[model samples]
Every structure is written in structure tokens, then in C-alpha cells.
Target chain A: MKEIVVISGKGGTGKTSVMGSFSYLGKSDLVIADCDVDAADLHMLLGPDYQRSEDYYSGELAILDQDKCINCGACLSVCQFDGIQSENGTFRIEAMNCEGCGYCQRVCPTNAIQMETQKVGEWYTSSSKVGSTMVHAKLGVGAENSGRLVAQVKNEARRHAKKEGKEIILIDGSPGIGCAVNSALSGADYVVFVTEPSVSGIHDLKRVTELVKGFSIRSGCIINKCDLNSQMLDELITFMADAGIEHIASIPYDETFTAAMLEGKTLVEYDKGPASQVLIKSWEKIKQFAETEGCLK
Target chain B: MKIAIASGKGGTGKTTLATSLSSHLSETQDVVLVDLDVEEPNSRLFIRGDQTHSQSICKQVPEWTGDCSLCGQCQEICNFNAVIKVGTQIMLFPELCHSCRACSELCPESALPLKPRKIGMLNQIQAGNLIFVESRLEIGEQQAVPLISQTKDYIDNHFDESYIIIYDSPPGTSCPVIEASKDADFVILVTEPTPFGLYDLKLAVEVMRKMKKDFGVVVNRDGLGNNDVLDYCDMETIPVLARISNDRRIAELYAAGELIFSTIPEFKEQLLLLERSLELSTVVDPV
Candidate 1:
């Protein structure tokens, strides 16, 4: 099975929106995964009928036993985060501040602190209205271990794809060059790097492309809002050419793309406008590119 | 006063609001802009200045000195999964390491030595009328929270109490956002008006409430999608600090890497209003 992850280093560059459209445009047997656990919103487009919800545990957190606590402040001294809070003469471990370093448990004098696996997030398997089984997750606000969560979401997507005999997994990836993005792009057959024509977008595109190249992944490019700056588009083309990355498609800036999202529908479903046609054409190019890598065969 | 501009999702115009307000406020008051969005810091794109200061951030990672047997005590004690021992080989993954110092302390042979590894860089960019503190993590580095924390520490170390500090944070309600927003007097969450906006904004709201930080929402791209964001803010009784209308002229300015206050003369009035509302207030229950 092959997985094509759609990611953008810059935020709001239409990674999720493109993935939403792909959910409708792609083959019927596609298992989709939303790997943006930190701010997952792909389900906003798909409106999945969640079938199962499970707690995700990664990393460990120290819980202080009030009974065993001698109020010695030993854990407080070792904590670099100041995660230990002294409240009304009793100490408590601030979960957000705790980095799960396990130093607090080790520093406890009376064994007052116990290490427990933290439920940092939740994952779900849902059937989307677009007829694809979706695997998505929500990382707890301010929670770490997002890389582990993204891995779980992808693993679940692959398992679902195997059970249903689906040959492809479409992942909606997160922004930035963080561990979560690494997790989404890890072991993927192809990566579709989406970006826009702007200074920040170009700046981030360079960094993310460098990241993808390090993984040795075959990647394609989709430039959204290419009409914003012809100069930037030209720059992007030259950069992609020099980097040996595939410049698959460039879609012009259109208000309908946002309008379609406002209506809770994909561009093609909302209106087969010029922009929608461009996206459809781009999807075709992506399929051909993936096929070239023996992904379809 | 320290005000942090944060968003639950990426590309929600945190830099737009922060830079606009910083530029406007610098007209009269002392101001410092801290770009804590280490991974993809773009605030530098909006502002121009000289490099006043620069520093490389280093973390302590346990490096084996190859002195003795690989008894695997270091690997067993590491919570970050940064150390792995295969056969006689002891490999240290610096990227995954959190530098908790437990592994090095627990090593039986005292073979593990704390080695300083460069993770990112910190800069004090001299923008017009203010100092802009920015952090840029090295590409392929996984841990941003440590780098973000050091950046915050740098701000505190040389804090000028007279200046109004504005922190422009990375998107997402993750560890990076938390590290940036941890000590802010007030957090101004910049969000767009859409389903995705509301969806992520709610997560951001949950994070702020958990931290008990003084926060209010500023609905950006007001007319782009729908009233879901505003309606949710009203329903939650959370203070709706400001609404930045989505005018094509503004979009053009932003696309061209220009600040709204500089190009659009009339928009300065609204930005000033946002600047005024940033004063610390008693927490209004958003119940």
C-alpha cells in the first residue's frame, strides 16, 4: 500500500482543504488519516461519523501521593520546569509543565511521587460522508508526545487500509518542521508539498523541502494561490527545479476556495468553478506522479 | 505588560496582529516584539531592523565517552527514548533527547558525559523603535519546547520593565505555544471566522483556561467565512477583543509583505483600538 501525505510548512496554505477535496476526488478505497493532532480540523471538512474513540497514552507523568508526601520539596528542587506547585502547603504536579522526565519520581524522598502513563490525547476511527474510513487524533492542548500520536494515527490508518483492502492512505499533515510533520511524512510513498506564493510561505517551503529531502522521500509540489505573486511563483519554480522536486500543479487564487470551505463542502462539490477544475487537474497530476513511483502498480 | 499573540491553528494572522500592534505602539511607548515561533518564524518578514544580538541555544545531551561497558542503565533511565543500546553499541539520539540529566547521573560506569548540542539560535533583532527577540530552530530538530523556553528565559534576563513586550507565538496549542504563553500577562488569540477556525480556537481556549491566562479573542478575516467564531466567543462569554475585517486591500498588503498600519492609513485606528484593549483586565468568566 502507498501513502501520499499532503503537507505545508506554512499554515493555512490549504493542506487540509486540498486533502478534503482529495477525499472526494480520490479512489473509493482510500483510508484517510489526519495527522495534525495538535490542531486537527480535517474532520471539519469530512464531518466524519465517529465510530470509535480511544484514549492515547504516550510518555509518563508524575503524580504526587499526598499521603506519602512529607512536604520536603525534594521534587520541587530537581524540577527545571517548576512543574511542582505548592498549594496551601501541599504540592501538586502541574501536568502541562511536567515534561514527563521522570526526574520528579526519582527525586521523591519518601516515594511520594509515582509515574503514570499520561492520557495526552484521543484518537478516533470514523467513516466520512465521502465514504472513506478516517483515522484522526486530538493532542491535548499544550500536550507533548505529538509525534507518537501522529504515528498511532498513521498506523491505525494503515491497519484500516489493510482490512478494507484499500491501496492508498491520504494523510492531511500538520504545519512546521516539527516531530509531528516528521511522523506524517515518515514511511510515506510520496509527499505532496503544498505552498502559496508569499514571502513567509516561500521561506517555510524551503525549510520543509530540505526536511523532506533528508528523509529521501519522493515528493511533488502543489502551489496554491499562485496568482498572488508571479515573481514568487517564478522563484518557487526555480527552487523546485534546483532541488529536483516535482512541481506538479499551481492553482490560482480564488475566493470560491474559501467560499466552498465556508459552506462545509469541497470546491468540486460546492461549485465546479475554474479553481475546482484546477484542483481536479492537479489531483490527476498527483495520481500520475504517484503512479510513476510504482505506487499505483 | 506582556501580551502574547497566539493561535490554535497555523496561518491565523498572529504575526499580522502582533506586528501591526507593535508598529503602532512603538509610536509612543517602549515595546519589544518576541517572535517565539521558532520553527517557521515569519515576523522578520514584516519588520526590518539591524541585528543587535545573536546567540546559539545549546542543550545538554548525554554522550558516551566509550570508557566502559554498555550496561544499559542510561537507556533504561531515559524517558525521552533518546538513548538506545544494541548489543555492545550505545547510540545516542540527540534530537529525541530532552536533557533531563537522569541518564548521565544513573550511568553505572559514569561513561555518559553531558555534551552541549546546538539546537537553535536566538536573536535580538533591532526593529524600528523596539527590539525584536526571535528564535530559529535548526531544521530537522524535533524538540522546540526547550528552545522556546530558553528564548523566554532570555527575554526575562534582560527585561526592560518600561517596554510593553509582545510575544508572537507559533500556531497550534502544543508545547511550543504553551512555553511561549506560560508567563504572559495577557494572551490575545488571533483566529479567523470559519469552522476550522472555531474548531481550533476552541482547543486554544481550552488551553488558555487551563493555564488561567488572561485571554480574549480577536476574530481575523471577519467576513471570510461565517459568524461561527464570533458566535462561539459570545456564547462562551469570552471577551471579543477586536475584529479585523477581511478587506481585499488588506489582503493585498499582507500578500506583499507589508504591514496594515504602514500601507492602509485608515486601518491604524482599529489597530490602535486593539492596542488599547491589550491592557491587563480582571478575568471575565467566559461561562
Candidate 2:
């Protein structure tokens, strides 16, 4: 199945809104995957009825046995991270500070420390109101290894797509150039970047675009809030042209986008406004691009 | 006093408030504004300053130098599987490595030794009374927490207790945001008035409460969003720091990378009140 992932370098640029509309349009033909495991919001918009869930464990955490403790301060000395704590001659591990390197476990002569895998998060498969299967995950607050959780969600979506013989996978990626975004971009057929015309938006777009170039994946750009600043819009257009990124559609700034979100509906599902029309046009272009053979080659 | 401006949702005016508040406070206090959103550091675009100093930062990761006896102990102890032992060689994956040094230190053959790998850079800029420090992670690097920790360490080493520090933290309630605000004296949570904003703001508030941080809420684009955010804050007993109205001029200035205080009188007045309140909150008792 072909994969179309939507991401915005800067947050609040309507990435989820665009993805929600795309999911509504591609409901019958695609499976939805929300790879923003750190703060997954696609499930909120899709109203997914979760059917299956599995606990996901990625990295290990150190566990100390106080009974076998010989307060030599050996584990604390060998730890690169400040994970070990000592108070009143008792030692404990700080879960937030631990990197799970297993160095402390090795240094303990009393065999008091052992590495145990942690269930950091969970991934789920659900059927949404739009009559499509959605794969998403929830990372525990302040948990590490979000990139792994994203990978797990994407894999599950791809597996379900293969099993159901779906034609496409529409992914909603996280906002940043970090590990989560990187994992979401891997092995994607096409990427759609939703961006705005603000200075921070343009700045972050350039940074994230540089990252996408490394993957050598075909990408299209959708300019949301195109009418906010004419000068910045011109500059954005010039940059996109120079970067050889396809300009999909220019969506005007409209409150209807948020209004639709407030009502727990996609823009296309809520209203047939100008913004919705532009989004529909953008989806058509994306569909044509995804179906085109030799596009990746 | 150290303040962090953060939001769970992106583009919620963290950098906008960080840059403007730092510039205004610099008029009477020594201020250091840090851009801890290393993945996408945009504070540099808004805060123009003279280049004072810059340096490349590196993290220590294990590398094989062909000195192994095929002991395979390095691969066994690595928790992240960043190191792997092949038939006649050991392979290293820098992207997967957390720089935990478990593999290198546990190797009995001494083949796996820690080496410095470039991950990102830190640039310091001086703007009048404010010293702006921005850290940018190199492309393809996965970890942002280590660089953020190092940048905060740099600030702690260079600046004394007198300087008021402001951090423009990353968006999201994950590891990066947690690292950015873990040591702040006060946190300013920025949010919009829409459902998405309120939803993400609730997650951020939960994080702050779990961390036991003293924080207030700042409502950007107040007229654009509904009153749910204010009502939620009232019910939670969270102070409303300031409300920036939804204005085209503000958007225009932000698009042009201009400061809001210099041209917007209403915003300036709101920031002044915020500054006074922050001063009263951060005052230390005399010995």
C-alpha cells in the first residue's frame, strides 16, 4: 500500500485538521496511522472505537534490591546519568533520570541491581466513524522512547493494511525534527507538509525540509493561512519553488477550520466552505500523485 | 529567577512571549533568554543580537577500533541495541545510541571506547542587557534532551544568580519539554482558546502539576478562541497571566519577525503587568 504522511515543522499549523479531512476522504481506501505518539490527537478527531490494544515495551529500567545493598556508592559512581539517589544510607533509582544503560547493573558487586523492561506506552487499533481502521498510540506522560512507539504504530498500520488489502496508509506525523518525526518519515511513499506563512513557520519549515531531503522522498507543500501575510506568502512560494516542492493548494485563513474542530468534525464533513474546497482539491492532487507509477523512481 | 514559556500544542506563542518578555525585562534587569526548543529553534529569528560566542556540542558514544578479542560483552550489555557484534566485527548505530556508555565501559577487551560525536551547536548572542543563547540540533540526530541539558548546564556555569533567565521551551508534554522546565522557578503555559488548545493545555497542566511547578496561563489569540480555557483555569485555580487579543497587526508583526512591544501599546501594557507580577513572585527573602 502507498503511504502519505502529513507533517508540519511548526505546531498549530493545522496538520491534524488536514489529516482529519484526508482520512474522511480516503476512508474506504486507506488505513489511518497517527505517529505523534508524544501527543496523539488524531484519535480525538476521528472518534475511534478502540478494538485492540497491546502494551509496548521499548527500553529497560534499573531496579535496586535494598536487601542485598552494601552502601559502597559503586553504582552511583559508574552511572553517567544521575539516576541513582542516596539518602539516609538508602539508594534508589530515579525513573525519569534513568537512561537504562545497564551500567549500574553491571557495576553492582552484590547483584542488587537488575535491568527490567518497562511498559512505557500502548498502541491500539480501532474502527473510526469514517469506516476506516486507525492505528495510534499513547505514551505515558514524561516517558522516553517516543520514537519507538511511533514506529510500532506505523508497523501495525502497515500490517493491518496488508491484511485487509488496503490501497493506502494516511499518516499524521508529530511536529518537530526529532526522533518521532524521523521515524514517521521512514519508508513513506509521499509526504505532505502543511505549513503557514509566519516567520517561525517558515523557519521551522526550512529546518524540517532539510531533514526530509535526506530521505529522498517525494513531498508536496500545502500553505495553510495563505492570506495572513501576503509578503510572507510570496517568500514562502519562492522558497517552495526553489526547493522543488510541489505546491498542492493554498488554503485561506478561515475560522471555519477551528469551528469544525470544535464540533468534532472534519472541515469537509462540517461545511463546504472555501477552505474545505481547497482541501478537497489538495486531496485530489495527492491521490493522483500517489497513484502515479514511477513517481518514486 | 528562571521562567519557562511552554505549550503542549505547537505555535502557541512560546517564542513570541519569550522574546518580548526578555527584551522588556532587560530594560531593568540582567536577562538571559534561552531557546531550549533545539529541534526548531526560532527564537534566534526574532531576537537579533551580536554574535558573542558559538561552539559545537558533542555526545560520547562507543566506537570499535579493531582491538577486540571477539568477547561480545559490549553488545550484551547495551540496553538500546545500539551496538551489535557481527562475525568478525562490531557495528555501532549512533542514531540509536543514548550515549549511556554502558557498552564501552563494560567491554573487557577495551575494543569499544567512547568517542565524541557531533550532535548540535550552541550559539550565544548579546543584545544589550539580554544575552540570548540558542541551541540547534544537527539534522538526523534523534535525541534533544541531552543537548538541552548541556545548554542548561552552560547557562548555569556562565550566568550568576542575579540574571533573570527565560527559556522558550519546546511544544509537547514529552521528554524534551520535561527537561526544559524541570528547573524553572516559574512556568508560563501559553494556550489558544480553541478545543485543540484547551485539550493540549490540560495535558500540559497535568504535567506541571505532576512536576509540582508554580505556573500560570497566558491566553494568546484571546478573541479568536472560546471562553473554555479561562473557565478551566478558573476551576483549577490557575492564574491567568495575560491575554493577547486576536489582531491582524500582531499577526503581521509576527510574520515580519518583529517584536510586539515596540509597536503594540496594549500588548506592552499587558507585559508590564506581567513583569510586575513575576517580580513579586520571584522575590527572595533576605538573610
Best by DockQ: 2
Worst 10 residues of 2 chain A by lDDT: A288-297
Q: Root-mean-square deviation of each candidate, in angstroms? A: 3.5, 2.4
Instruction: Give the clashing pairs for model 2.
Output: none
Model 2: CA > 4 A from native = A293-297, B280-287
Candidates' C-alpha lDDT: 0.86, 0.89
Per-residue lDDT tens digits of candidate 1, residues A39-139?
A: 99888778788899999988888888899999988888878777799988789998878888888888787998989997889999999988889999889
Q: Say which candidate scores most in TM-score.
A: 2
Residue-level lDDT tens digits of model 2 in A1-297: 899999999998999999999999887788999998877878778999989999988778899999998988899998877899999888899877888888888889999998899887888999998999999988877778898888889999999899999989999999999999999999888889999998888988998889988888778899998888889999999988888678999998888888888888999999998888888889999998877654322
Model 2 vs. true fold: TM: 0.97
Across B141-248, the per-residue lDDT of candidate 1 in tens digits comes to 998889989988888889867778999998998888999998899999999988888989999999999999989998888788888888898899989888888776
Worst 10 residues of 1 chain A by lDDT: A288-297
User: Each candidate's fnat, in order?
Assistant: 0.79, 0.74
TM-scores, all models, native as reference: 0.95, 0.97
Candidate 1 CAPRI-style tier: medium
